[model samples]
Target: MFSEDPGARIEEVFRRIQEERMAGLPFINPALSVAAVGFARHGADWRGVLLTPWGIQLLLLPAVADWPVPPLLTRAFRQYPAGTFAFLPNHEKELGDYLACPLISDMHPFADQQTALATARACLIALDIPPVRSEAQPAAPASDGRRRFLGLDG
Candidate 1:
């Protein structure tokens, strides 16, 4: 529904959740607040990071109108530049259908909001990097390179 600015809408929705449901929870970090980071159009979806007191997640919200909502509690896989990741389907009354790939499930490790925000941004950067592929190398003979490299051949 928020085709123009889905990130702002997401922040608002989670802010409400923070106030109504997450307050005083033991696992939530008090220093962190709800935020949407690096949101931009990605094909037919808006991709970004959602930072909250409880966790940090990579969010994918539909950009098109009338996008179908997947069944709740089901996992969906989406491909990013980094790699394919599993996202959980969820719907918010205000935010509508979206997918979330949790990057950090515990916020307690972060000392402050800035540190958490930095981590969220770093995650976005990491997601943009393509996964590395290594070529296989032939194994060296045990008595040859292995012993020589260790200077034990003599």
Candidate 2:
């Protein structure tokens, strides 16, 4: 059962997790709060970054109600415009079945929430950009006489 406001639902779920399970953890950043960043419909799912006290993650929730749930702890690969990413299937009673790909597993390095949010946004933008592919090209003969004299020509 996907909520009408998935971002708010996600925040609520994590905030509760933080209170019940993650309190007093050394890796939890005090400056960060549970937030869903840049959530929008991507293909058949809602894709976004989720910032929590413990880490930042890229989450994919079903846009439609009939989405099938994968077995818990199973790994799933999702194709974005940029590349393929491996996600772990998870289910929350509040958010239902979703896929999570951890972008940052440690929140200790983030000095403030703003920085973490910015990084999350950047990750979302990066997912839409195709990776650059490098191709090998034959080297051209050195045109400069100085290069030939110095034996620098390839």
Residue-level lDDT tens digits of model 2 in 97-148 = 8999887878888999899999889888877765443577543332322232
TM per prediction: 0.83, 0.82
Worst 10 residues of 1 by lDDT: 142-151
For all candidates, what are the clash counts? 0, 0
35-122: candidate 1 lDDT, tens digit per residue? 9999988777788999999998889889888755678888777665655677789888887789987777788888998998888898
Report every candidate's CA lDDT.
0.78, 0.78
lDDT of 1 at 45: 77
